[model samples]
Target: MSGKAIVAHANLDPYERTIVVSDIHGDNQGFLETMRQVEFSPQDALVIVGDLLEKGEHSLELLHTVMRRAQAGNVYMVAGNNDTIFSEWYNDEVTDEEVHDYMNHRKNIILREMALEMGMSWQTLEEVRALKAAVPKRYAAELDFLNSLPHILETEHFIFVHAGLKPGPLTEQDRDFCLTAKAFGTQLHRFEKPLIVGHWPASNYCETIINVNPYFNRNTNVISIDGGNGLNRWHQINYLILHREHIDFGAYDALPRFRALDSQEPSKDPLTLGFPSTEAEVIRKGETESICYLPAIDLEIPVANDQLYNYKGKRYCYNMTTYCLPVQAGEILACCDVEPRGLLAKRNGMVGYYTGRYEFLSSDDLLLKKEGKQP
Candidate 1:
């Protein structure tokens, strides 16, 4: 009942492989498909590093799926910051004013969705109290699963936490920090084993290029596997698989696949590899878009100025890419964003702006085209 750090030690020897994933953010389909791509089996153990219950379209549904799987066994989950915050609200720890603000921009919140499903609303204090009690009683299993989730999962070779950790004894680490650690990847920590984390997307750690793949910092033995799911359409669920002393990563998303129709031409100007995936300082703020400079890569790019305010004194650009894409004929990619600048596409885990010819590599599109109709 007292929201605190519950560190758990895991033994994955029984399974043929130990699969680690994080920041699922309620994308149940993407999670399942990523496992399918990796050929997930009963023989494999899955460790969802965290953020399993919020942000995507199916927060509560994803929770049920994870609950069912965990009940079936071979599945372990850690508490993400979103899960922790929700727990705090549910336990009456959050003040009325705080809850009001939290529920203000209500979108994809698990608790809100659960209440809505039962024809309940939390706009008023009476409604909040009534639904809070009713929700847990009706969905006792889901609540219990969230309540029982650990903040950290440890093994001989790896230490899995939703967010990052402070360098020290695992038990003494701050509960909230472990649940919502920021920039833990950049922080130097010499753990005996590799520390795997989510919450913070792996691409944000990249300064020069856009890579949603797991980031392995050999120097610190820290591996970040949050592939920016739920943050944007381009991002996907990153899977970290450990098998036979080898570690690999895979990603899956809901974006439609496509193939290049023509080869890339030579660029006259300098090649912009990609935009800075992390934070950037605002240089010129525009009405619709602002120019921000990312000190990590010394690149200035235009970003959507759609935020009402900054969180934790940190600002981020959701859409910022100036790199031109070069694609060979037949190169496969997933369509991410489309703009007058070019089609923003991700190929081989790297995202870039493509001006070249391309076609949707989908049967649905083919079917529509075969009927002589524009899709």
Candidate 2:
């Protein structure tokens, strides 16, 4: 398929609502729940802001689900960065050498996991090449659908794009600006239309917004609805409802899970695990006791002889053999510091240092905690 400009105009009646969502990344369950919560009907329009494929396990399924919906009702999608990359691969813009290099040496654990899910063996570059060759054949329909997606969709009151447009009129914007730009150079109030986007997570701009739950930039007329789905357990699928003269927010719960392949060895590569690196060495507190960070699992696994060490009002004792502790997704950890390292935490009952951030906390649970209520 050749690159083409797809600009769709949605003409809706007064009672119809336009629901926009972004960055699904293959969270099929979350997407279904969002649809069910809204009680989606034939009258309501659905707009996806991109990054629909990759990362999660059910990307192919999610693509089919959206395609089916598009046939039945008004549904539109903007091509995202991941969609662009996959398009390149499908259109032969991505060479076999590049795929080989990515599979063998690239530090992108998510991509590697995705390749494994697509039937590529993790052992060799030849397997990567085979998978690349077979993808176009296996997912020809999906690839064609992805390649056909537009970069921008405009209406009378709103400009819906995967990311943000460049610093000019919509007609003058390029594909990169629409599909990949992370931030608008200036506030979009000059355009006189609200620009709905998904790419940057709402949590990234939480500090600046009064209601961080749905991340809206009132000054710019830009609304970001990506809840970081597929990034971790803390994020969810967020949807923005555009009605007559108003916009509302709806979120669906999305919990992170260990990728099928990564679940087996959750901490095999500490450097490429997408966490910050630290140089703090293991210090031996005394004989048969050592305070150390395990590179395999990205957690501080303290070792003590038989007595407890009191530090910062938390008691720590060695419970298992050194370098044997394992960490997985969905495990709750009480952390004292949000830093990548140097955290005093408790999992179950044992006390140690947790390296993961509270950013992984569920949004619904966080709201309850903030309101002094139990979830």
In lDDT terms, which candidate is top? 1
Q: lDDT at 211 for candidate 2? A: 21
Predicted candidate 2 versus true structure: per-residue lDDT over 235-353, tens digit per residue = 56788888955788877663321111111122332221111222223655645445756454567654433324344454443222211114464555543212123233333322234
Kindly provide the TM-score of model 1 when superposed on the true structure, using C-alpha atoms. Answer: 0.84
Query: After superposition, which runs of candidate 1 have C-alpha atoms over 4 Å from their true positions?
Result: 1-4, 265-319, 363-375
Each prediction's total of clashing residue pairs, residues at least 3 apart in sequence or on different chains, is 0, 0
* Per-residue lDDT value at 155 in model 1: 82
lDDT by candidate, in order shown: 0.76, 0.60
| TM-score of every candidate | 0.84, 0.63
Candidate 1 per-residue lDDT, tens place, 131-192, comes to: 76687678887777888889989886788998888878888888888877886888876777
Candidate 1 lDDT? 0.76
RMSD of 2: 12.4
TM-score of 2: 0.63
